[model samples]
Target: MQIAITGTGCYIPSITIPNDDFAANNFLNSDGTPIQHENRLVIEKFKAITGIGERRYVEPHLNTSDIALLAAEKALTDANIDKEELDYIILAHNFGDVSSGQSQSDTIPSLASRVKHLLRIHNPKCIAYDLLFGCPGWVEGVIQACAFIKSGMATKCLVIGAETLSRVTDPHDRDSMIYSDGAGAAVIEAVENGGKILSHATRTFTYEEAYFLFYGTSYRPTAKNTKYIKMYGRKIYEFAITNVPKAMKECLNESGAGIEDVKKIFIHQANEKMDEAIVSRFYGLYDRSMPKDVMPMNIHKMGNSSVATIPTLFDMVRKGNLKNQSIEKEDVVIFASVGAGMNINAVIYKV
Candidate 1:
């Protein structure tokens, strides 16, 4: 029983925050103290370093569930399936929708449930849940959907990764420049002779680096920068270059595929340079030169939308929205992401 991806969709906000916006604002620390660095040069250096030019921010009234609903509708329409036909809705997001002026998120009802309601899906048998796996949340959702379908527990599943990161991101934190808001979704169904989902692997480093990046509900004036996302960027960069390739290799080995067979690698659009380096290193392990168009990127426009990155990139390429990045039937593809929780995962897919 192979899991087949029937359709895909994405919803990016209209508001594009250019790098200059960060330069124009005077940033403050979590304690309300002014930040030391704020300049056009800083933005320039950021772009040179991360390959991000501008990013998306949701409209004033939209929430995580709102964009997710839009993406789901597009995915369902693409799949040519009714909303009621979905057997499961697996949504991924680190922070729930943050209401205006709120410093934190509230996930009491779960974003997936909210989307289910918005879609008017009344099938009690259809499970709706949220999965938190840092930036790999969307990919994890797909892997779980495949498991459910393979086990006869589900016939069709809707997987979504949506986030309004701008709401929770601290205006003072430099990381705010890199975080954005968006949603991406895919419809996966069990089909005879589909054999679409090839293989996947996951790993978590929770003992020492578990809290490397975290988001909390309230602002603490005295605590160690716990209000917004705080991370050791240098350490994360090292971890991605070191560990991601190994995970990807294992996924490929399990799929019985070689690096040369991969048509495109849809990586989490966190840092353009880091993603390129990771893929480069992964192919290096095989002692084979990487193909020129093996990696497709949108970090320049989308930044790190966490869970939304991979799915949105895939949809963009699949629809020919991205220049020089496209896929064809039976084309081999790979997906990988690493983020908070120090978690990493990789998947092999076929078009």
Candidate 2:
């Protein structure tokens, strides 16, 4: 039996926040000093580097779990499977359920468990849990599902990647503009015929890169004791370009596929420039120029929604929703991501 992703879905938040929406924000330096440049210049520079002009935000009443359940339901319907038949629910997220206007993250009941409950699956045998592997969480969840299927621990699984980065961002920090909120999900199962997983690779570089992305106090000194999602932008870009390509090359090589066979690459939507650099360097590994349109990007409009990027992009492309992008049967694709925990991972898949 081939382990494959049979169905996919995503929930893009309804609220569209354009870059100009942040024009009034009091941007600050890491040391709490105000940025000398006007907000327009700042936002323009951010857009130039990250390719983000707009992003989506959940409505005031929604939380991470709510959107996750929304995506999960769609995935189930797309997969055309009874909820009771699911053997696992794996939800990958970073800051869990940060309520509107709140700083605390609520994970009392794991997001996966909450999604299962919301899905109303009564089967007690369906194991549910949350995974925190930074932005690569969703891709890693797929890897975990393949493991369970191979080990006879599961047959049908729902893997989800959701995040409310908007809720956890610091208004004073410039990096806040790089974040948004969204969720995506997929149904993974043992199939008689369809897409199949070919190979995967994962790595953690904690010795020195552990703190590249972390939770830290606000850039404004007056903000008391509350921490928000933070990162060293330059550090992450350098880390990604230097390492992410190597991992993708490693995974692709392990799949025994030639470089020309890869149709598309679904890389993490962290930054437009960083992603382009990574892919360029990836092709450089084979001493060939990067193919035209080998990578599809939505970060220009969607911003960085963390773990939600890859799966959501996949769902959109597979359904012919992303303009000029689509996947067909027997096509080879690569999924990769890098984020907090200083973690990186890549998967080789065939549709």
Against the hidden true structure, what lDDT does model 1 obtain?
0.87
Candidate 1 backbone overlaps, count: 0
What lDDT does each candidate get?
Answer: 0.87, 0.95
lDDT by residue (1-351, candidate 2, tens digit) is: 999999999999999999999999999999989899999999999999999999999999999999999999999999999999999999999999999988899999999999999989999999999999999999999999999999999999999999999998999999999999999999999999998999999999999999999999999998889999999999999999999999999999999888999999999999999999999999999999999888999898898999999999999999999999988999999999999989999999999
My TM-score estimates for the predictions, one after another, are 0.94, 0.99
Best by lDDT: 2
- The parts of candidate 1 lying over 4 Å away from their true place are 28-38, 216-226
Predicted candidate 1 versus true structure: per-residue lDDT over 13-78, tens digit per residue: 999998988876655555557656656766777799889999999988888999999999999999
Residue-level error in angstroms, candidate 1, position 88? 0.8
Off by over 4 Å in 2: none
